[model samples]
Target chain A: DVKVTQSSRYLVKRTGEKVFLECVQDMDHENMFWYRQDPGLGLRLIYFSYDVKMKEKGDIPEGYSVSREKKERFSLILESASTNQTSMYLCASRSGQVRGNYGYTFGSGTRLTVV
Target chain B: AQTVTQSQPEMSVQEAETVTLSCTYDTSENNYYLFWYKQPPSRQMILVIRQEAYKQQNATENRFSVNFQKAAKSFSLKISDSQLGDTAMYFCAFMKHEGKGTYKYIFGTGTRLKVLA
Candidate 1:
């Protein structure tokens, strides 16, 4: 079974705090992604890494950064957490696939709240 | 670039019934992939079914099937004997065959489904 694990399930932080959300995949997938989901907005990609230390900006990348130092772990960082940053964050990984196996296995999302 | 659309913002099915969720996409590329993903309350998104644009036949997985209309760029999911566990947010996604290299997904605004016990 493929397992994608997030560092936290629920997090609360001050408005000025720097936050880190970690994701680790045991399946050795080559592609990983971070997405923030809002009520009616569905899931919007923040960033993605196709390989270790290689990253690409998605549709929304402002106020966020990512790290992929190792092949199994990807991290999403909020430079300065804000009230607007409160939402469900999801991490996903996919194997070396071009089309048919494009299905991404996702982690149980982390719901973060900024005060 | 490709875009996915889910026309139904919300849907409901009584337990043990059948339901269909609509999805449409716009892409100029001929060979691509379409997928249906279900995000339950637990916030874990799971792949429900997949459809390849080049394939003429629809795809199915037990109770979950898809009606793939390639010409119209339409991909719809049909759930048979819908159970309470089937209630979730269903997202339709599209990914282009970017050679034999990498492929990225473009997802739709999901449809929220409710199942009555």
Candidate 2:
């Protein structure tokens, strides 16, 4: 089975602290994404990487950054964690090699609480 | 920009009954994909069903099926023989085919479904 593994299931961070959420996929998928899920906003994309060392800002990328050093790993970074940033973060991956439409495999998600 | 809407925030259905979750989307692209994703209490999102815009026939998977209306841009998911395991948050997503395997998904706010015994 294809798996998207998120490093943390739950996290608590102090305001102004830098935070890192890691995601790794074993399927060799070339596309990785980071999204933050909030109550009314649903899942808003923050960043995505289509290839190693290449990243693009999604709809909501104000306080977030991403790094894809290798094809298998993608990391979402919170430069300065704020209380407003508290939400459930999800990591997803899809096969770039696949033609046409394909569904994404998402990780279990990381619920972050900022104080 | 593409946007997905799931107006029903919560829904309840009895076992063996059927429930349909509504989803509507707005996009200019002619070719795209629609999907229903289930996020269980464990917080893992899984694909339940998918529909391609070019296909006129509704897609079905076992008891799960979709009612895709291309003209109205509506893609609803119907779950038959509801089970306790079916209780979860369902999200409607839209992905515009960018060609060469490049696309991004826009998801709805989600509908929470609870199956009663």
Candidate 3:
């Protein structure tokens, strides 16, 4: 089965701290995405990478940055963690229409808390 | 920009019954894709069903099916014989077809569904 693995399931960070959320996919999918899920706000895209070393900003990209050093890994960085930035972070990966279906395979998600 | 809307914030249905979740989207593009995703308490979002804009027939998967009205830009999901396991948050997503390339999905706020025994 294809799998998307998040490095941490839960994390607590202090204000002004730099937090990193790591995600790795074994499917070798070319497209990887980062989204923050909040109650009543659903999921908002933060950043996505379609190829190695290439990234694009999504709907909500403020206070966030991404790295795609390899095809299998995508990293989301919080430059300065704030209390309001705390939320559930999800990582997803998809292949480029190998079978005409572009469904996303998502990780279990990382719940981060900023204090 | 494409936007998805799920007006029903919370819904409840008895087991063995059917429940429908409403989703509407706004897009001027002639070709696009709509999807329904289920996220249980575990928070693992999974694709339940997908509908292509060009297909006139609605997509179905087992007891899960979609009502795709391209003219109205509405895609609703219907769960037949609702089970306790069906309780979860459902999100409606929209993605425009861009050649063979993949586009980002715009998701709605989601609706919480509860199945009662």
CA lDDT of each prediction against the hidden true structure = 0.92, 0.93, 0.93
Candidate 2, residues B1-117, lDDT tens digits: the string is 788999999999999999999999999889888999999999999999998899999999999999999989999999999999999999999998675655768999999999999
For residues B26-50, what per-residue lDDT tens digits would candidate 3 score against the true structure?
9999978889999999989999999
Report clash pairs, candidate 2.
none
Off by over 4 Å in 1: A97-99
- Residue A93, candidate 1: how far off, in angstroms? 0.2
Note the DockQ of each predicted structure: 0.82, 0.89, 0.89
Off by over 4 Å in 2: B99-101
Q: Report lDDT (Cα) of residue A50, candidate 2.
A: 90
State in Å the error of residue B50, model 3.
0.2
Docking class of 1: high
Cα-based lDDT at residue A23, candidate 1: 100
CAPRI quality band, candidate 2: high
TM-score of each: 0.96, 0.97, 0.97
